[model samples]
Every structure is written in structure tokens, then in C-alpha cells.
Target: MACTQVLLLICLWLSVSDAFTYLRVHNKSEVTVQDHWFTQRLDHFNGADNRVWEQRYFMNDSFAQSDGPVFLMIGGEGAANPGWMTQGTWITYAEKMGALCLLLEHRFYGKSHPTKDMCVANLRYLSSQQALADLAHFQTVMTEKLGLGNRKWVVFGGSYPGCLAAWYRIKYPHLAHAAVASSAPVKAVLNFSEYMDVVQASLSRNHSDCPRMVKLASDTLIELLDYKENYIKITKDLYLCEFLVIRSEMDISFLLDTIAEYIADVVQYNNDNREFEGVKGGNITIQVVCDIMSNESIGSPYDRYTNVIQTIMKSKGEKCIEASYQQFVKDMRDISWESSASAGGRQWMYQTCTEFGYFQSSDSISQPFSGFPLSYHVQQCSDIYGEDFNFPVVTAAIQQTNENYGGLNVQSSRIIFPNGLIDPWHILGINASLSSDLVALPMQDAAHCADMYPARPEEPPVLSSVRRRILELLTEWLQL
Candidate 1:
């Protein structure tokens, strides 16, 4: 083809592609109080054309026209339900502070399903980088479609979204006026090693009188590790003896991690499960960690172990008696005693261990872990053990924030990081930059998000101070 003809074809392709793939925004509906939920569609960067990305946000109380600072709310993992307690609770508070609230659901969660096939396809795309991009794109859409041009908003979030909030300001400091990260993971990845250490320290510090109990707990773990084979043997036996059933599909780690987590919980677990028949009245203190970690196995450890031993002996026949169990026992004992750092005793120890690169297993192929998605397992075990379970994605997200935010050379832009002292996830060990624009508030006994509590009769004194600081900063920010 001639040069002129080739140029005309290229131009035609560019125009057609732009028209087809450019981002498009549509207004869905306006709520009673000037709040509107809108959806936007954007073409994927990769040429995966079938995947149409969609995101939603709530614009409340003059977000489009507000001269005051606008509040953009970013939620943590699996926060698809827009009406969840935290978002709902803070909506009115944002309005009261003279700020328009914008709540955006993280992609792959809630109504923000950007792609289909959640398990196989979407899970791969669900990362901190993509989430940050989605938020940025939504900001641009809101600016053009809602007439809130050139007005920067403040980003806020707790738990997982806190990391996003920090990243938003870091990545687009010019787009955000300020940022407020509550219970944010703005430093390291979620280290299970550090988290378990916090749990162990908390237990020992809070319950010094239970030294004997702690020692017994430690000893039990050592014994279990030492007799991994025999322990499995006995557990199998016990399960079969009770139910007269024979199933060799037992996962020993499940039992160990479950019991480990149970022991971490502050409360004692004294239940009447058929599996614990042999040790029903035994002095081993059980807690919620064990129960939550334990999958629904039908039999007891005693029966399960016995069956395993019997099977092994039967299979070996004459050779079984001559087999040296002493070496195996010694190795187990070694792993049990030496491998366990006191910091590794928390119920969510696996999460910190995997994320912070501190976990080691004698046998390969462990359970799926990292204490993510904040399911019932985390909520029950963490709450029972006095351990806070936040979203795990915050780990990578925070590192990105620090890298970008620290390099911005931003001045006159303030960042307020609020955290609860008792929030074991963040672990009361963070070093904030000593800049005039940054303030760190460590609230006492506040748990996680301290701003949403009604002053209670049994509340800790620090809760009052936390509440006070939150009001002070927010009120001053709003000029209320």
C-alpha cells in the first residue's frame, strides 16, 4: 500500500480503538440525602476484552460541590456489603464533620466485581497494585462526571483499606489533601512471627500467675512434636475406638495448629466433644483457637492415633518390632523444644510466620494460611485470644505507600495514623517519621477502630483519650 493509504488506516484504527476502549461513567441513582451511587466501566490494560471492569462509590452530602475537604472511604478485604457496620456508622459522622463521604468497595468484593470466575480468574488480578489503580481511576471519574474538579479529597480507611489510604496519598499526593489511616499496616508485611510473639507476650504479661499452665502448654507441644508418628498413632486409635470407624485421611497439622491457637486464647475451652473423651477431664486447658483451627473431624485424637499405630504394625508385621522409634522420637523432641520460639505461640502464628518469612516445617505441604479475608476462623480465634486479625493485603500495600509517600517530598500535607494499643496485629511497635506534617496516636485499650464507641461503664481510660484525639483532629480538620 502507498504511504498515504497506510497512514489513513492507522488513524482509522486509533479512532475506532479509542471510541471502543476509553473509560465510560454512568450515573445510576441519587439517594434521598444527596448521596448517589454510580458505576464506571474501563477497558483492561491487557487485551482481555471480555473482562469489563466496574466499580461503585457513594457520594454523600454535596461531595460534588463541597468546598470543604471531601472524605473518600476505602474499605478492607471482602467488604462488598456497603451497609456493613463500620461504613454505615461512619457515614453520618462524616456528614456531621461537614464532609462529603465517598465509600468505594475494593475490587473482587461486593458489587465491584470487575471480572467473573472469582476463584480461578479474578483472584489473580486481586492485588494491592490493581486496587490502588481502581481507586485512582474512580477519583478521576468522580472529578469529571460529578463537577468536583481540582478539589483534592482526604482518603481514610481501617484495617486493610488503611494501607490503601496511605498508598492513595503516596501515589497521588496531588490528588489527596491529607490522609487518615486507622489500624493501618503502613510498614511491614503482616509478619506472623511478630504477631505470634505479641500473643505470647500478651498472655505472659497479662497472666503471670499462669506460669505453670504456660509451661505445661509448652511441654505438651514438645511431646506432640516429639511423638509426631506416635501422636498420630494414638489420635487415630482414639478416633476409631470411640466411633468404630476407620479413615486414614487425618491431617496432623490441623490438630497441632488448632490446639496451639486454642492455648493462645485467654479463655479456657471446656466443652463436651466426643473426640476429647480420653482427656475430657484432663488438665490440658483448651481455648477458642484450637476449636476454630480444628476442621470438622468426626473422631477423637486418641482413637485416631491408635488406629494409625495398629495399621503401621500390621503392615510391617515381623519387621515392625525391630524398627527404631527412638531416633524419630528424639528428632520430634528436638523440633518441639528448640524450634518453638516463645513468639511463635499465638493463635495466628502461621500468618506472621509466612508473611515475615519465619515459619519452618519438618514436613512439606502445610495448610492454607496468612489469616486473610477475616473469616469466622480469625474472628473467633483472634477475639478469643485477644489478638486482632486485620487483612493481610495491607502488608504489601503499606510497603508501597512508604516507598512512594516517603519520596514525595510533600510538605504542608498532614497524615494522622491512629491505632489501638491492644490491637495485637499492629503490635504497638511502629516508628513514624518525626515530621511536623505527621502525627501518630497510640490509643489505650481501644482494640482496633477506637472512634466508633459509646462511652461505656467498663471502658478503659485510654479509650477516652483515643476518642478525644479522634474528635479533636477530625473537628479541627473540618473546622467544626
Candidate 2:
């Protein structure tokens, strides 16, 4: 799917609490936001190579007091946007606390490219350890450059960056005072089949029949792939831009994975309403998707599935869905920074292949979706980078990551992990408080960083209380 369309689905479904009416709204023209760059080492692990790169960061000091705290929003896999300075509940907290806010774009993402290109050789420098080091160095450099003396720094991030926020406090406890890791997948696994299991659970929570219909649709599509004539029918029904070909298992995986992604995208961001730099949120909720799937007027389960894809494609203004594995490989194979795949796709995939093997596969029988298995993603690592990044290497890397970071057993203080109960990624996040200072706050009816957004009237009461609790924790930590 197109980035904007995916973002639209992501942003539109958010529901929040009613405590953020006091958030200061700054006109874009009023905020004097400027792009700041800091010189950072390209390879923090290698002391021999002295190569440096300019890292991008943005700051908003509109509410800063002389002795106030610092709020650092860590950028994740995607490009960091300056708009976050003015939006999000973090800004609300900053305004209330009179804290200075800063957002650091992750290396190799957005305009903060550490290298000229994203080839396998250059991407070797991209890892979670390197990113954590970037944060430690950034804090030290910025504290001196800005003359910040003994000010408490609170780190905030969602999704992948959320994991980083928790890990940062664990690795460099002296640098940051507190962290808000929202919807963070702290644990790394080779086959994330639980991802789809949660997706089905979320769907069933909305309507029990929805999962049955989704499974039926998937099975029907798989059966159709056996006949050559059904290929043309599937192509026409799904509205593919190219002819559907099932010459290999990879091709079959591509088709099923593409279909599963449409559903997963909705479930992941269902009710998440934060707006991005250039994209606005929509109302494509799980209920909306289930309604489409259950509407027998559309035809069979397979026909309804086709309609789901067509609805998303039409919303994005895409002419046809791309289901060709060769085209996908060709796009990912392009190492140039100018390629469309460079917009976090290739970079994130590399991180998954190396540091985090978070491959969401349908290997489990409990999940509704099927066809794409563990080997499908393992092969992708080999096809995109090289055979060196095979299953054994990737497995070892995940093991090392868990050993280094402590994964679910991460021992960190003054960190609040707020996760949505319905969010698929919550399977790997901390669901209960480990101690008094290290807290796990699970929102009753939330999904994927819903707490990070400004509170809304329709949000569950637990969400309202969670925001208040987060503020309370931050206040207590800063006082210490």
C-alpha cells in the first residue's frame, strides 16, 4: 500500500480520554522550529574508523523554564517529522511541566542518513546498540552545547522507538531520568506468530464471526491457486496490476501476505488518531472492516476479501495492487537512497534481519491468516542482503540482543510502559509492573500508542487514568 494511505488508516482510528483540553495549540507559523544537526560517529562500535555523520534533531522550547525538565521523543523506524513538536500528549506534558522538548531522528532514516547509500555494507552500521549509543552521545553533547546543568531528561517513544526508550534507560541509566515506552515490543522472537493470534483476538473481540469469515476467505483463496484458470479469476477479482503467477512458494507467500497485511494494518492502528506530518487520520476501524467482511451482499467470503483490498486501494487512489514477488525483490534490491523502498522499508527490514527477527509469520494454526510462514521471511533476508544474513546468523543476533538488553526481564527504574490491550505488538511488551518504579500500564480498550496522542472524549476511562498516572510518575521522578 502507498505510505500516505497506510498512514491514513493508522492515524484515523485513535480514541483517547478527556484530560487534554488544556494542550497548547501553536500555529505552524508561530513555532520557530529549526532543523539542528549534531556530528555523530557512524560506527560507534568501531574505534578505528573515525567517520562522522550529521544527525538531525528538532527542538521546541516554547514552554521551557530556567530549571525545568527535558522531554526527548526518540524517532523510530520511519522518518521523524517536526510536526511532533507541536502535537502529541508529550507536548501537553511539556507545556504543563514547562519542559523543553526535543526529537532526534533515527540514523539512516529521514534526512539523517549516516551513509551515502543503503547498500548491505553501509547498513551494517544500523543496529539498536548503535542507536542507543547515538542517544547517549546526543545527550552528552546537547547538555554541554546548550549549557544544560543537571536537568532531568525524560525519554518518550512508541513502537520500535518505544523499545529503544526502555533499552536506553537500561543500558545508560545515568543519562536519562525517566522513560515512557508505549506499545514497545521489548522481547525479540524468530517467529512472531502471536502477532496474528492477537490480530484474530482483536477481530473476535469486535465480532466472533469476523475471524471465521477471514479464515474462510484465506482458505478459499489458497484452494483457488491450485488451478491455472483460477489465477486469472483471482487477478481480476483482486484487481492486481499484473497477472497473478504462482510458480513458486515465494509467489504464493507474496499474495497471501499482501492480503493479510491489509487486515493487519487496520488491526494494528485501530482507533489510533494521531496525525503525521502530511497525513490525516481516518475512521477505518476493526468494526468497519468486519462489517465489510460480514456483508454477504458482496458475495462469498473470497469476494468480500477482494472488496476489502479494493476499498483500501481505492482510498489510496492506487490503480491496482502490486502482488508480484519479482517486483518486490527488485525494489528492495535497489540500494540507492532515492528508491521508494528507502523510505524505512529497506532499513527496517535490515534491522529485523540483523538485530530483531520480528518477522510476523502465520505459522500458528490458531491464527486466522495463513500461507506466509517462517521460511518466507528467512528467505527474504537472504534475497535482499546476502546468504550471510541467513537463519542461523539472524537467530544468533536475536539471542545476543536479548542477552544484552535483558528483553522482557529488562531491569530499569523510572520507566512507564503503557501498552494497548488490543494492540498486536503488546504480546512482547511488559503487561504488569515489575516493581514500584518500573510500571506496565495496560489500557483496557486501546491499540498501538494510543496513550501518546492527545486525550479525546470517547477514550476508555482507563486511558484517562493512565495519562494522569504517567504525569504523576514523571513528576515524582523529576522530584527525585
Candidate 3:
């Protein structure tokens, strides 16, 4: 069957959603919202399966004409925030194109979860293939509801969902006229150390000494933690509420994760990019971190990292810093630590372990400070999902995904693959066009989903060009 025409997904906006405080609840508290729900089959491919689920959806028909385009926006790894429905680059373009915009929550995410319990058995239905099926069913029912069965559709998403946009067109072309996949990692990878390599590159671009200082501090910290005597010193320097002996490899991995996460944020969000309007307080850049590290007036490298965490925490206006909070270390030891991360990251963790395997592990190819081994990530899967779902399943899933979807060798057409050159995830994304119809629009100096952010007045020249190209292609697709 032809893939139903979905809206042109601009960007996954993972980083944008991460840092930006676009208040979905408070901003549109009294906007007279028109949220709706539909009954979706739990297993779309099964004829005998009778399980049904109520899926959440939001739509705006004011811009629709009798025979207008259908814009289907998809969410990823988190709840479908109402701000996306109310405003964003996608909605802005929908208005310009006279399209009926619809935002569909991904199954197993947000309020659309099919199962009552988040058990391992329940997450079996959580896959990109299933989510794509939801899009098709929703498009059919929605087109009928709006009396626009004849209208063309385009699919749009960012990051994971962005990969879905490209896959939607490839997997079922008849339903969608075209797709816009921004920052989509179409090729599933196992050892994702390149993500940190890009993090190093991002810091290098900001200032050479930043990454060097980072490596210096990281190696020194790991060495000191090896000795039992330095545990107190490590705790005091990093501002931890308690001292922890390195009982397991996971212990230091957690500490490494905390520090790497902060660096990843700066690079991925370009939090220091003064020209980027979406990221507030351009003070969070790598240069600022380096300045903190280099100052003789400041304390040691451990103290520098503490300041970095404090700066980020202060900007968030939160009283308790996760790095300093006692529970932060406690959760690392918990079985459901993955779930405790913001926006219920457990679902995404399951997806990554089972299908994507984008575990940001450190190898010889990565920075010297990057000591997060492949075993640690594998251990995390065992820690969270138990023993049955082992490394073989993940290996098979990665191989199967590539074989089925064409992976990096996608032969599909009429899809715009926009990736920021600086996005570490781009290592697995479609960086070059496969054909004339399948275009690769690269944001030379942007970060992950940088193009997906709300339109800024001082946009980078490449981003502006890519936006124009996307609008043009979407316009042409609607006409076809």
C-alpha cells in the first residue's frame, strides 16, 4: 500500500526540547485546545491479534482548504509538548502552505502507551515499524474525518522520528508524496563513540584548549578514583553529597556520564552559539568551560567541572544540582535508573538496546578521556532489561534494520535529508543524496536539530538556505 502523505517533519528537536523552556502547559493553559484520541490496534501487522489502544492526537483545520495538503508531525522519545502544536517552524510553514496540521503522538510514548505496565513484555510493541503503522492508520482516519481524503500528505520528524519520516517514504511510498527528515540517523549503529568524537570536534571548533583541558581533567579524575584514598577528595571536589567507593565499573561510568552529558549538551544544542536565539544565555559554550578550567584564580580540574555543573544548574533555576544531589548516585545503582532520567527515558533505552543500539561508548577512535567501554553499555542493557534480551538480539536487530530499510544505501526518492555537520548523530545519517529526488541538505555549522528550532532572525546562512530549500520542496510536493 502507498504510504499516506504525512507532514514534512522538519527536525526531531531533541536538543531544542531539552534546553529550551517553551512552556507547553503554562503558555497555552487557556487556548481552548482541541485534543482528540483514536483507537489504534496494538499490533497492526497481525490479523488475528485483537488488542486495541487509544492514541493521542492534536489537529488544526483552520488553514485547510477543500483540497489542501495534510501535515503530519511525529514526536520522539518524549511527550508531544503542546508548544509544537501551537507554534514552531512546522506550524509556521503549515500556515504558509494552507495545510491542515496534525500532531500524532508516537505509540508507547506520551499518553498513547498501549500497555498498563512498562514491563519488558509490554515494550515489545515499541518499534519504529509499529510507529510507522500508527501514522498510516491515523492519516487514513484523519483524512476521512476532515473530509480531505483526496488531499496529499507529507511526513515530518526530527532525530528518531526524523528517521521515521525518511523510512515512511521508503517503506510505504504510496501514502506519502514526500518527506522532510531533519537530523535523522537512518543507519543504526552499535558502537557510537563517534558521538563523543564530534563532541571533541565541537569543543575544538570553539577553542582548542577546551577539549585538551577536558581530557586532562577526565584522565586525572579516573586515575585518582583508582586509589581508595582519593574517594573523599573526589567527592569533595565534585561536590557530591556523599563518598562512594568504586564498587563496580558502573560507578565511574555514571560519573563519566554526568560530565559527558554536560559537554554533549553544549555541543549538541550549541548552547554557546550567541547567534542562535533558541538557546538562552550563550554563556554555556565550550569556551566558557575552558575559561573556568584555565583560570589560576579558580580551583583544580575537578572544581572546574563542578562549576560547569553549577552553571548549568543555576541557569535552569533549580535549587538542587543533580551532580551534587545524593539521589543522583543512588539512582545509578537502581535497576530502573534509565527510567528515572527526564521524560521517562526508559522507553528510548529499550528502543536503543533492541533496535538502534546507539550506545555512546568510548573506544580507541574516541578521545582519551572517553573511557566508557562497550561492556558498560552492554551491562546497562542487562541491568535494565534482564538476561534474556542479550547482545545477540541487539546485534541481530541492527543487522535486520539495515537490510530492511536500505540503511545508508537508501534508494528512496523525494525525501529531504537535512543533517547538521556538527551533529555527532550525523555519523549514521544520510549525509549525501542517493538520487536527485533524495536530497541531502547539510547545515554546515549547526548542531543536532539546530534547523528544527524556531526561526531566528540571525540564522546561519546555511540554515537559511536549507529552510528555503525545504519550503520549496514541500511546496512542490503539495502541487504534485
Q: Output the better candidate (1/3) by TM-score.
A: 3
* Residue lDDT tens for model 2, 81-120: 8888887889889878989888999998988888767888
TM-score of each: 0.56, 0.93, 0.86
- Positional deviation of 340 in candidate 2, in angstroms? 1.2
The TM-score leader among the candidates is 2
Model 1: per-residue lDDT, tens digit, 70-97? 7788855543333421233344445455
| Lowest-sum lDDT 10-residue window in model 1 | 1-10
The whole-model C-alpha lDDT of candidate 1 against the native structure comes to: 0.43
Q: Model 3, range 120-141, lDDT digits (tens) per residue?
A: 7666888999999989887776
Candidate 1's TM-score reads 0.56
TM-score winner between candidates 1 and 2? 2
Instruction: Give the lDDT ranking, best first.
Output: 2, 3, 1
Q: What local distance difference test score does each model get?
A: 0.43, 0.85, 0.72
In angstroms, the error of model 1 at 457 is 4.2
